[model samples]
Target chain A: MATVRAALVQEASAQFTSRQPLVLVVDDDPDVRASLQDMFESVSLETAVFESTAEMLQHGIPDRPCCLVLDLRLPGTGGLEFQAQLREMNQFVPIVFITGHADVATSVRAMKAGAIDFLPKPFRQQELLDVVSHALRTEGEKHRDGGERNTVRRLGESLTPRETDVLRGVARGLLNKQIAYELGITEITVKMHRSSAGRKLKSISVADMLRKIDLLGI
Target chain B: MATVRAALVQEASAQFTSRQPLVLVVDDDPDVRASLQDMFESVSLETAVFESTAEMLQHGIPDRPCCLVLDLRLPGTGGLEFQAQLREMNQFVPIVFITGHADVATSVRAMKAGAIDFLPKPFRQQELLDVVSHALRTEGEKHRDGGERNTVRRLGESLTPRETDVLRGVARGLLNKQIAYELGITEITVKMHRSSAGRKLKSISVADMLRKIDLLGI
Candidate 1:
């Protein structure tokens, strides 16, 4: 009985941990939000909808691969203002804007602010679907790339400060002599740090070591 | 009949003129090019292979969605220089680099120069295929976007010089009075220019006109 219960718990936990990719729809109109939700659902995509920025903010961001479908003319904190807020918080989630009243100036600001795409309302359903998919894929890449950098950073934590300096030099395409001179260390010492860093990071070649260090922001 | 003969000629011309999407593989290694060609063929994508940049250059760019799969360590010109050459010629084709010897410095330079993904040799076949598809999609978007910008530019040419100045001011989110003051013109003149610009572009709303002007580089 205990074993069966544990198996059931494990299955439930697995389902809970593995999230479905999502699209967050933020629009003031009920019809717009509902239509968007249904459209995403037709493609087997999950979505959460909000009528205002305040409500959307309360929901927080999900960890799964997701993109925002923001209506430009939202109540209170307009789409551009909310986008600025997201940027100030250093969140780089992909966003697609939908507006009934499309302006060149506002759209340019939205694009400059890093929006994925802008859809003028009465837009074809297929166009929105295409942009949604593109935004999700772009967000997925950012997440994966971020995770990769984190792994590289973890590996970097094992390096000594001297080893870190040596790794940076190599990553910059500097020779051991240049690194040694820059650090006021002997060439032999620089070599030792490079080797030590390599071994600690399990890197097999200068190229591989440099790749990791660069990813780690060395 | 004349119609039947015309139809036959039209079909033949269509077959010759309608080109398929292509991946251009440029590498010094004959084997690398061959393998890449086979991989693309497996996915029903077309490929053209070359042993050097000089040979690749001779063919010129195709008027279709395409990307270059370049080897970083070519015998002459090398990948980076060749990328520079393409840029100098006002070509912005997407490039994906593959190298057996990927060092941090060269890979970084390759990325900074806008090479897509840098795959080390011994990468999975699926990885290459995925990246190739991504590069093709990216190139496809660039072409589409360029066409969109061109259309916007053509629309912009309809505006009179004063209208163009007023469009710029409004695109900057400046009020009519502010634009008038800045341009040393009366508020009424600024309004007149804005209205004339709107009428010429057939823009129905402020947002719509602003979007076009922004794309037109106002």
Candidate 2:
């Protein structure tokens, strides 16, 4: 397995560049890791091969847009346990698991743990590529949403309770008059709150503020 | 299989009086279909089970909001062929596949054909329920978008090509001045196009028009 990891990294160094999305490949079997690296690199994705879960954690994961192609049978920590650890660390990067011993119980558990897809061993290159692409796209969307939500949270952290209420109403697509009526305030007061909230958030338009709120899902 | 179909229909009939979402379970195995019907019914979803592809096609899928839990190893047409047929008919209903022999190639192929998820045989009841819920939610979103798009298309069909172009630009988050600059037209002409397009689409504001356009992904 160690040989497999070294060989995969060597091969990936020759084939993939930093421009492509990085994929971490974790499997105990050397052959499996090498094959996966070859397959993903063929699609122009950077691949990092790890022989075990310990190695993966020790090597440290990159903060770039990436995903995992993990094998269920690992040496140190099993795939399912590793998945739990990753979730505990709040690493929501998408994962696609490959397993030789296919079973309903394991697959179901994996899906419930937020796996993007699970493939049995001896998969075709196209099959792997398609799943990887889907995982990458899903991760990208999620990462973008996370960034927007962070921005929204930072912007909203300083708002007063009343102003936050007004912001929620605005985010829900309420008009000024409607918000004023709902809040039992005059339209002029509602306008004042809106302007103040906008200034505090550094947003120029209601739409931009709403977009941020939408990202926050509030 | 026939017994499963009967049980599913009975379950569906019982639930149809309420507003629960319906699910169509297509499989050749009686036990599999029966299990799925029980699982779905437990979660307050209607289930209609069929023994074969021909039976499903003969019954004619309902226009109501629904999804399919298809079996990969069907008697005649099989899962992949049925999926292709559904795609050919332009049906975008989400599917969750059940397979006795799960493999990477088969799962990937099903996903590419728009399956929301796949579970191997002997799956947990909660597993099926979770995937079904996700699939229904996704299909619901798509249906809502499709309804909005249909209304927009009906209205946009009456517009001239230039008006449609301006409408698209508005949907793409462009201002009238920016659209005019991009199209090499006067802002007045752009406003005229926007107003005409909005009136034709029965929209009151640029925001509504933009929402419709976003729903249509144009």
Candidate 3:
């Protein structure tokens, strides 16, 4: 196990410089770790394998979008307990649990606590890969240009009530006349509000305004 | 089953006149439905019981905050399949699955597809009630005053960039001078922006501004 851990760390460190999405695996069984390492690496995903939650915590979470593939029945702290611990520590890492001893109650508990997906052991390689891709994509969305989001949010905060209503209607694909009818305003007023909103948001096109509205998440 | 369903409908119709959150139950066994109906009503909760998804659909979803308590293995459409069908129809009612045939795969699938809770048969009454309360609470959040949300969002959309920054800092509990320092502006400028934002939002107090910020869900 020591030699396997050392080899895994060396391989992971070598791949870390590439800044690719990471998949962290924690299983007491060395063979399972090796198999997962090979499987994730086959899809060009970097992996850091550990024998227990303690070891993974010791190494600390990588500063990258990553998902944890955890074994349900670990040596010391179980996967569910470790998940709670991470939550208490405010580490919101996505987790996918695998277990040979699958039970409905435990699976329900894990899902209720926000495990991304739970897979019974001897699962398909494709299933695991697809779930990992989904988890990574969710994490990536959170990590995307924070500065850009702040700017968009600030711009969204700059509209008047009428301008916001016009833009939101536009975002919903409403025509200016339809917006006017909905708001009980004239079409000319709708146009004025639309153009004024565009100016305030510094957006040149309807598509750009739509994108900004999406960013506001209304 | 027809007689049992009729009795259930008659009882439910009598209770529907009162405006209360409804709990819809669909289970094949008459005994189970009766038990659930009694349990829910014992706590003063309104319930509509059905033997299958077809029957529930025919009865129609209640026009208020509600949740579905579905049996996993029905004679016709199963619980998980019915959940998918509901999503297809865009009903989005929260669901809690109760099944005698407990399995990991199905539980995980149900949870992944957005089930509020999955319970194996012969579960505790309190556990089921707690989960139902949670589901109803979630549904209630969505049904909250849409007009108020629109008003708050429009007010949020009316803040200038600097005013937004100042207010966001305030919402995070930062002092006015600290916000000024962070924004590379003077303390007086921070106060000016804050006052302007308060007036624009029609929020007379810091607490009101904070509530508005929360409503914007930033």
Candidate 4:
């Protein structure tokens, strides 16, 4: 009984330690990475620092619940391009972009690409920590609920070509009769397609369906 | 027919005139407000400048779609508090916060509170314009969407007590069986509640549901 109790305690401890979210810090500057690592650690997080985006990609990101702390300027592929690549790969980990100047155009573009937060250079330690904490917590929650998310994404992708056409028309605020006229189908047929598409996307309302389509940017 | 044609011409002219979105500039400093008004008008946007929040609020906001250009420090209910009030009143017009000092803590707090962007004192003209343009465009899109986002927010707010409990547990990474046991409900019932909450929130997946919850900090 004592041995069994000891084993249970060990298992609980392992689970607790494993639950600490990991953060990947990718910046060319060693000092920045070190400081961020220290800050994240102080908050009971585990962090890995990479000097370049190349180094980060080479190491192959771990499957552990994680987020990327990325610098806006990097060697080779630049930050913006890297972000574009991540989006193309459907890697939706929350990103906190760090930059020297908060250029308005660049910031707008980054936000449109789904970056969670942006911090200008010479930012306060607490500001960085706060954003990082928020980002990691967000990523951790995503990891926890990834199963349902992937299922939805997959279901959205599996939509038939005709259903997708119907969806785009719906998103344009087309009425059911209008969609049927455009698609050369009966109104009843339009309703059937719409219902099927919504079921696959796990969406119940037309507005919800439109929002999911927007999120996928399709 | 002639009168109708003349009225149509006048309406077309008004549409052209209203192409440039109006901006409400709120700052206590006359020079700053005037300078901003001049700058924005040069870019063809309409500007209404005020020296205080009270003045702007009293004058009543513009009837057309608009965003606020706010100074962090004001006479009475300051920028931060005004922002809080705006959110409480569910007036989600985008805000661009300007400050004379580079207060990181305040800036982060403002960003977390949904300020579209933050600009420090001595910002370049282009920087200010860039942020304003983005804010205006975002606000215009929201208006054009006919308040679809408000529907999402309202649905998110309507989660039942049991659903909220299940959502928190799901965010914390509990499996369905685990949540069922924790809530003392059948697993089928847990599934029903989870699906219902997700539907109500217009979330296609658990991750999306969690993201909405995190955004609302519920």
Model 1, position B151: C-alpha lDDT score: 55
Model no. 1, DockQ: 0.01
TM-score of predicted chain B, candidate 2: 0.67
Residue-level lDDT tens digits of model 3 in A60-83: 987678899999999999999999
Candidate 2 local Cα displacement, residue B208, angstroms: 4.2
lDDT (Cα, tens digit) per residue for candidate 2, span B28-62 = 87987887788788877889999998899998877
Give the higher-TM-score candidate: 1 or 2.
2
Q: For candidate 3, write residues B1-218 as lDDT tens digits.
A: 99779667755654442346889999999999999999999998899999999999998887577989999999889899999999998898999999999888989999999999999989998899999988887676666664466667766776898888887787776778889999999999999999998898887545467767667875
- DockQ of predictions, in order shown: 0.01, 0.15, 0.23, 0.06
Task: Tell me the spans in candidate 1 whose CA falls farther than 4 Å from its real position.
Answer: A1-20, A173-178, A186-188, B1-218
Candidate 2 on A165-204: residue-level lDDT in tens?
7877776557788889999998888889888988887876
Clashing pairs in 4: none
lDDT of 1 at B38: 95
Those runs of model 4 whose alpha carbons end farther than 4 Å from true positions after fitting are: A1-20, A27-46, A60-64, A71-92, A96-131, A143-146, A152-218, B1-20, B42-44, B103-109, B121-127, B147-218
Best-to-worst lDDT order = 3, 1, 4, 2
Q: Which candidate number has the best lDDT? A: 3
Please state the error at residue A218 of candidate 3 in Å. 18
Model 2 DockQ reads 0.15
Question: Which regions of candidate 3 fall more than 4 Å away from where they truly are?
Answer: A1-19, A145-218, B1-19, B145-218
Q: Candidate 3 clashing pairs?
A: A157-B157
- Predicted candidate 1 versus true structure: per-residue lDDT over B69-146, tens digit per residue: 999888988999999999999888888888888654465456656666677787798987887898787666666666
